[model samples]
Target: MELEIYQVDAFAEEVFSGNPAAVIPLYEWLSDELMQHIAEENNLSETAFFVRKGEYFELRWFTPETEVDLCGHATLASAHVIYEFLDYTDQAVVFETKSGRLFVDRDNGRYSMDFPAWGVREIQVTERVSDALGVRPDLLFMGKRDMMAVFEDEQTVRDLKPDFAKVVQLDGVCMICTAPGLDYDFVSRTFVPEEGILEDPVTGSAHCTLVPYWAARLGKDSLIAYQASRRGGVLECANLGDRVKIAGQAVTYMKGTITL
Candidate 1:
């Protein structure tokens, strides 16, 4: 079997600066095992596979190890592929996903995605959390699928050198460390060693939690955010009580055929 694949750097103005996701558009669904193999071979943070379904698309995301419920950067990359390569003319694209209906709109060169707002509640800071991150957080919160650790400054979040072994032992799919940004409204870094991604470059889905938290903390509905990964990314964010809007640009990095 031969499948066309596109590698896109999401939330970046240029290549090599954001989270890279592989997008494969299929006419019909492939076997889960086969898709997982493909994602593992791609070796990217997330691989998005979608099938056109009338006016919308059915999308799924996979990491090297397993399928995930939601992925922001991959979704953005998928929309970019549909619009830029698949010759899609619609101003917006709708996706039916595990997380429910997702919408991505294209304005100029930027793609804005509407995602669910995930609220978090305060959690006790554990010794394991501090050992994993090498620093204790001032505030810790638990979200739907992730744990958030709040710091007082951006430098602390950026300077973290997590022990991936210890990080994987923590409860939740991933851990998010965030603090007030120096230039933007907030800054964050996401780690998921269990899922084969030690750190995510530009996490759009994490922003679902970050936007709401920062909006309430900063007392603003609109804000700018930066992910402090080695390959960083910037996001334009808006909190809408139940949903959040994350906007960023994507660039094509590679396009080729995958043979199986």
Candidate 2:
């Protein structure tokens, strides 16, 4: 079978400036192992697989190592591939995913994602958190698939050099260390060694926890965010009571087809 694959840099207006996700627009579902191999072959953080089902679509995410329940940047890439590549009719697309219903809106120059506000619960700081990060954090919190450590300032988040192995020990999807940003509302970085990913350039799901965490700290519903990964990404985030909207632009970096 021949499948169309597109590489889009989500949250970036220009190519090679944001998190790149591989998007595969399918008319039908493929085998699980094939999807995993395709994602591994892409060698990016995530490769999104989707099939149109009426106005909405069914979306799945895969990393090099395993299939994930949810991923933000890749989902955005799928939306891009459908609207910009396949010419799906609609400025917006709804994805019925394992994570639940996700909506993506095409804007004047960017895409806006409406994601659920993650329920973050505080937890005791394990020795691993201190060892991996090489510092003591003020507090620790764990969400459905992420671990967060509140730092003293943006510098702490920037200067962190975590032991990726220790970071993998955290019982969550990813490891996040965040603090108030001087130039933006908040600054953060994500690590997911367990998923065979060292650092995620841009994590849309991490912002779910980040939005609420910063909103409560800054006493504001809307704010700007920056991910300090090597590629780097910027986001305009807003908390809308029950949900959070993460807004950023995407660029088509590469387009091709994969034969399987």
Candidate 3:
């Protein structure tokens, strides 16, 4: 079988500056095993597959090792594909996903996605979490799928050198270290050793937890965020009750057909 694929740089204004996600739009669902194989072969942080379903699309995201319930960059990339490549004329796109209905709105050159706010609660900072990150957090918050380690400043987050081997042993989906940004509202770096990602260049879903926490802490409804990964990325964030809006730009990097 031959399938067309697109690689998009999400949360970036240029190629090679943001997280890259593989997006494949299909007319029908392929077998789960085949999709997993394709994602593994691509070897990007996340690969998104979607099929049109009436007014909305059915979407799923896969890491190299497993399927995740929600992914931000990949979802942005998928919307980019739909708008730019799939001849979709609508300015708004709705996706039926494992996390329920997700909406992306396009205006001018940016895409804003509405995602569920992940519940976060203060947690005791264990030695395992501190040792894995190689830095003690000022505060620790536990989300549904990940943990947030809040530091005092941006330098603390940027200076971190995590022990991925140790991180893998710590319970939870992944770890995110964040602090008040020098230029933006906040800055963050994500690591997903359990999902085979030593470091995620730009994690959109992590912002779900970050947005609500920072908004409440900063006493603002809207804010700007930066993911301080090696590649780096910028996002416009807003906290609205139970939902968070994440906005960013995507640039297409490559387009090709994969043969299986």
Candidate 4:
């Protein structure tokens, strides 16, 4: 079988700067095992597979190890492929996903995605978290699938060199470290060693949790955020009551065919 594949750098103004995701569009669903093999071979943080379903698309995301419930950068990358390569002319695209209905809108060259807002609650800072991150957090919180460690400054979040082995032993699928940004409204770094991603660049989904917390803390509905990964990316964020809007630019990095 031959499948067309696109590699897109999401939340980036240029290639090699943001989170890279492999996107494959299908006419029909492939076997789950085959899709997992494809994602493992691609070896990016997340690979997105989608099938057009009338006015909307059914989308799924996989890491090298497992399928995830939600992924932000890959969804944006998939929408970029549909609009730029698949000749989609719609102003917005809807997706039926594991997380529920997702919407992506194109305005100018930027793609804005509407995602569910994940609420977080304060949690005790455990020795496991502190030892994994090599520093103690000012505050710690738990979300649905991730745990957040709030720091006092952006530099602390950026300078962190965590023990991924220890992070893998933590409570959630991902360990998020964030702080108030000097240039932007907030800055974050996400580690998902448990999901085979040691660190995620320009995580859009993590912002779902980040945006709501920061918006309430800062008393603002809209904010700018930066993911302080080695290959960093910026996000324009808005915290709605039950949802969040994440906007960013994506660029095509490579296009090719996958043979199986």
lDDT of candidate 2 at residue 106, scale 0 to 100: 85
Model 3: CA > 4 A from native: none
Expressed as tens digits, the lDDT of each residue in 106-200 for candidate 2 is 87768899999986899998788899988888889988668899987999888999998888877888898898899998899999999999999
- For all candidates in order, the CA lDDT equals 0.96, 0.89, 0.95, 0.96
lDDT tens digits by residue: candidate 3, 1-260: 88999999999999999999999999999999999999999999999999998899999999999999999999999999999997899869999999999999899879999999987989999999899999899999889888889999999999999999999998678798999988999999999989999999999999999999999999998999999999999999999989999999999999999987
Q: Which TM-score value belongs to model 3?
A: 0.99
**lDDT over C-alpha atoms for residue 228 of model 4:** 97
Model 2 misplaced regions, further than 4 Å: none
Show pairs that collide, candidate 1. none
- Cα RMSD for candidate 2? 1.1
lDDT of 4 by residue, 21-115 (tens): 99999999999999999999999999999999999999999999999999999999999999999899987999999999999999988999999
Q: State residue 158's C-alpha deviation in candidate 1, in Å.
A: 0.7
**Residue pairs with clashing backbones, model 3:** none
Output the TM-score of candidate 4: 0.99
Q: For model 4, where is the 10-residue window of minimal lDDT?
A: 165-174
For candidate 2, the clash count comes to 1
Clashes of each: 0, 1, 0, 0
TM-score of 2: 0.97
10 residues in a row with least lDDT, candidate 2: 82-91
